[model samples]
Target: MAPWLQLLLLLGLLPGAAPAPNEPRAAGAQAWELASPELLEPARFALEMYNRGRAARTRAALRVVRGRVRRAGRGSLYSLKATLVEPPCNDPTVCQLPVSKKTLLCSFEVLNELGKHMLLRRDCGPVDTKITDDKSETFSSFLPLLNKDPLSQDFSVKMASIFKDFVTTYNRTYDTKEARWRMSVFANNMVRAQKIQALDRGTARYGVTKFSDLTEEEFRTIYLNPLLKEEPGKKMRLAQSIPDLPPPEWDWRSKGAVTKVKDQGMCGSCWAFSVTGNVEGQWFLKRGALLSLSEQELLDCDKVDKACLGGLPSSAYSAIRTLGGLETEDDYSYRGHLQTCSFSAVKAKVYINDSVELSQNEQKLAAWLAKKGPISVAINAFGMQFYRHGISHPLRPLCSPWLIDHAVLLVGYGNRSATPFWAIKNSWGTDWGEEGYYYLHRGSGACGVNIMASSAVVD
Candidate 1:
């Protein structure tokens, strides 16, 4: 046996070596509970590597397993597991395979919830692997196939196990219960099914501004610095009229529209880029406008910091609002390539928007606003990294959306079958789902955090 394998077996004897055995037994036991010998060795090796140097590793040595069984497919599922090994020490004399004394079988899964995709793992919490949408459940596994897109349908043994567990547990815990994961699942699906209230394929068109044209230094000055400056109106305040109550019970799994934003590749403008997205919807909700604003404005103009990229939304919001507001994409175009924030990029403000308090229940709030228009909300940004997909549950503390550096907009709300949900707009280009949106439980704060009433915008 490989010395590394021996070390792993020896490490398994440690009292706390593996995840707690009492962890609810992966939700569903009978349906997809079978384990593979093939999975054990590879998974063990990957865990050792992660334990030894998770901070130093480059590529995630793990793979996400997702797929459908096709003709014989039962309910689909998504699973996570470890694969491959990238050791820093290639020379046997200078380095040996990292031992597994402190590693847990599901360590990688913990990292998944932590919001790091490059890291590998074997499984997620019983409820974590379940996707938030129903149509999305068709592709039940998370295993990224060798040649297939991560979003496409395909499966592997380890990944298959993930789906099987999800379905069985969901069936038992939710389906069996009067109301359980069912409500959350339906909420997510409803968001996935929504038609974009404003832009549809028939009317959608390409206009000015993009992330590719600006330099990283430029992106920061124009976009980030203004929000970060110790200036008036830059900081977001808590909702004054928000009622003090227990957190709202919500299921984000119902139907609405969802879409993936095109990857910006390796840019540090995730903060600016995400904020612009929410603001775009805000502008739309307020003025009935559909302008795709310039991310490069922050990339180039507000130079309190580096412009090429790297700044906070607090700064960006401050700069935009104080300068009387930003412009339409057509008025001040972006090059996609980044630069320092420049004076030239500060376009004239089309409108001045304010924030509102939530005095009513989320359902009541939704019903009330349903008649007016869409409202934007803020939620905590877990980490600096931009979220594309695969997240099913809350992995971080629930803070006011206004507090988190990242931002997204709340569009509409509805009941999926009978479960209630809030529809949210996403910036990850449209290929992400039925459209560029996702659903959250009506009060999950999963979409618009710290939501109450949107500060009404009069066009």
Candidate 2:
């Protein structure tokens, strides 16, 4: 026998040292009582290389057994008996053992110790050993690894069901690259959602249903492109200096100053939505009546601004003012495409005298919002593509303040659990965010919310 093989037999890791297959089993013996003989060659090679100080070769041999153990699952550990020549005891002098029978240590414990030793010795690179643990314990502990709290089995089932529903809901065809991409995105977003929820930052909870499958480009093209234009050289009018007593909390939705959330679909028409939303709030505040204005009017008639290709809310306001006025949604419905001007001064329902740009200071912005109605503003919406809610101020380095690319309606502000937030209404329909709204971390200039704050002057 090879010297390494003899050493393995002494350690009781080989089946040759165990009783014959026909021998009576001991009471409470596990099902995998016999280790497979195939494991001995690699084990002996690994030990031999380790003793020889060939770290690389030792790692290679250990990897072979590790792969087998992983493939065999944790249940196979019971069959792997390790003979401990030096038994673990509080007092070595008090320990006694029969000279004929070797002491068998728990295989799972021995394997774990071996893995730790290999890691400490740099024989193997760092690895998540928990992934190879007992299946039951592994699955139970998987959530924590992802920085999520333990989820109920029903929640897990529901998450799986949501993934299936997303495929059908988005009308995605299965088995294609796009389908596979969507699945990957959905799974990633689910994990992200759970991690966000675990943060307990606010009362909001994130989910993987709505915009999870859409790529950043797709999201920007559909919802954010309208605000992608360079800042126009025209100077914005300034509002009269108002008192600085901001309200404790305010929501235009509660006061009926905000309109129902509208979807831009595949059109880059958020510019029109933002303008119309601001006008809606202004009109409601001035006339004490709500009006659902036409976004299609802007798309068709606003030649100064691009319809679906993308435009700015400031430009949309300019187009509306240039066309003399804007019509109601019932008169000129949203087609989500560019068309020729169908402007009619006779059918115009509302008109803004002018629009004023607010200061970039968040405190001043908040004060203005408390006194005024909803404001049309542009923001850096990079991380907002999969935003599941919870004062969305991403800590990612890529979310720069200079990347302002999306236009939305700043409707209100409030603090939840002492965390202040800006209530902004998006144009991606009522199914997104807190019913078609997102709360941004207030007073931090989060996502460039303080960059381009502006409101229309309704008379």
Candidate 3:
């Protein structure tokens, strides 16, 4: 065995032998009743949850050997022993291998209540069945990426398993060359994510996201705006002080000031979405009617700022005022690309009086947001590519305030178990981080939350 393989085995990181990190810990068996209909349902529930968390290709068929159930408060606890059998073949055209026949004996405990089944604990050990060395004709071309292991510490085995999971989660299908390159990129990104996770001061979890397969440059060019880092030319007028202090926490979404989370698509139009979200909230609080404003209108009409390429909210506010107010999202729907000026003054629904820059102090920014509305701001977006959830507070050097890239909206501020965070709305749709929102560390000006803060002044 290789030295690295020996080390992995010593660390107990062998493939297929180790339970998933989020799975329940292994425990000894307890006395229980015999197999029953109630117990079978809970066992099936546990199996379903397990399968859902795994890659579609790795899914196994369940054959119950024994089962038992006991009553718990408002739910039932179940114990089950079963065999997990691997599928016969991956492709119908090439069926050279004889079912792979490999299997495992797993002991599972599940809790079921009101149609919700939760797997409590599972302990699985390899069965006597084993796979032959034969490879299918259809699968041989991508053999390096599809190798299976019942229990081994080989790097190839682990890499194959993880890469498969990532592709399945994102529903990605790539040719051989693309798949090889993406696997390399995925490996590199996971390392970066681990570093970010270790350096984070807050409770953020960083790992394989939807963007795991993409290289840093690809992610930046497609999703981030380079123009945000540029200076806004001249400084805008400073915001005035509010009459009352803000509460400890605030969220514009609950108050109906913010619109539904929208996607910016593949364009670098995060700047436009950020500005629109801020203005949307501003218009709602002032006019008492929530309206989804047009981001495409700004993309087409904002002469001072570039469309799809990148733009600044300060210049975008001026553009909104230049276009004789702004039109609704329905009037000028978004196409996620640069287009000719099709904006109409007669279709205008909401207008802004002017815009103001906020103080760099987070306390004051929160105060202004509480009184005004969501604030449009730019962030470094350094660790944002693979950011999953929790209060993301990367190290200052990693996510510097001076060099910002992506634009976002500050919709709310609150605490996550004593770690304060700013709920930021991104333009990447609800399927992304925290339901289209990024919770950044607050109070310390993490990720340039205090830098480049500004908003439209709706009448």
Candidate 4:
């Protein structure tokens, strides 16, 4: 026999030799195996690094670890019983892996060193393990990092999958599906914008934004004042009158038996709501009745343009006065609508000593609301979507905090012996805060008083 035939015969006769040349490959060929034994340690390390670097001061630690990962090239370069991704992203790299329970993913990223600055791009692949999905339904979580693609294919598909999972988790965590969906959309857009910025060497501009994003001053200059100039009928103002008594003292206006209304979401009608709330309270004080009134009228009809979605109480009061006084909550109703402003017989309810701060006004207001029902009060500095709930102040020195803007009704006040604090209601809805209410120091006058317009719910 020929030498080649002799060698082939010997190989075929060995224990694992196949009977035929066309035989299928065995399970051993396609079987899944650990990508690397080192995955566990590297993953943990990356997570720790991410947490440490979450703040500005610890960013240097991240840079140092980034350097280490750079040395771990993607190859059969195994060491100490673990497979680690090799760096110099001529291939994929991973960092900042999430803590989850459902799917196990190994992350990789590549960075382009630009002297003192570095551009980071990342990719991740599923590891086929039973783990938690941390990305599920979280509106603000699972944001994809910027992509610096040296290759033609985009990582957008994977990014989107992660985003979807984030939304899923967020929806599960947050009871409000609509709010979660909207936040998801906002987060995704923000991520995309960040990616664009990274791609352009960390410098790019976002185009125009939604009208709601504009500031009160910006809105006035761009829209409100102009509209008022062209359509004078839209501009409403209360005629100045001689005061029966001095303007009510801050303490008097601030004092009230604590109650809160849920914060309505950003609809650019805060002016209307604030003014309406004040009106509602004053009306009740004057006529001894309670009725919800029309906030929608200000939202729809107050076309003065200064503050649509972002309005002020002064403007809403002007609109009411311009339209020859607002009717009782029972007459026009407090539905959120925008009906045509019509002339009404109702006259503005006035509070005597509007600015006078009677002694122990806080105690008086508390007693009044405890006996009556709810009293309205004005707050300042509420300028975010989160205010739609009972938001804890990010800062402290709880002595005198004024994070609330606009005005809200104070229905009742109470305190537990264990927790010597007053409970207050908000208008942002019931799911917010400690069951649609916030607790503050009893005598601090943070929210216990303020002349929210009173109401008269006449038939």
Q: Top model by TM-score, which number?
A: 3
TM-score of 2: 0.61
Among all windows of 10 consecutive residues in model 2, the one with the lowest summed lDDT is: 113-122
lDDT of 3 by residue, 195-301 (tens): 66876888888888888887664577668887887655346898886757778999988999999999998677898999889988988888899899999998888
Compare the candidates by lDDT and give the number of the best one.
Answer: 3
lDDT of 2: 0.61
**Candidate 4 regions with alpha-carbon error over 4 angstroms:** 1-263, 281-288, 300-307, 312-361, 364-373, 380-404, 418-422, 445-459
As a TM-score, model 1 comes out at: 0.41
**Each prediction's number of clashing residue pairs:** 103, 0, 0, 84
For 17-48, candidate 4 gives per-residue lDDT tens digits of 23332233322222223344334344334333
What are the per-residue Cα lDDT tens digits for candidate 2 across 253-328?
8888988899998666787898899999998899888999999998887766667656777777787789888899
Model 2 alpha-carbon drift over 4 Å, by segment: 1-162, 168-178, 188-205, 226-229
lDDT of 1 by residue, 271-305 (tens): 45555654655566556555666666765665442
State residue 78's C-alpha deviation in candidate 4, in Å: 56
Whole-model Cα lDDT of every candidate shown, in order: 0.38, 0.61, 0.74, 0.36
The true-versus-predicted C-alpha distance at residue 315 of model 4, in Å, is: 5.4
- Candidate 2: the clashing residue pairs are none
Per-residue lDDT, model 1, residue 93, is: 50
Residue 259 of model 1, lDDT score: 19
Compute the lDDT of residue 252 as modeled in candidate 2.
Answer: 81
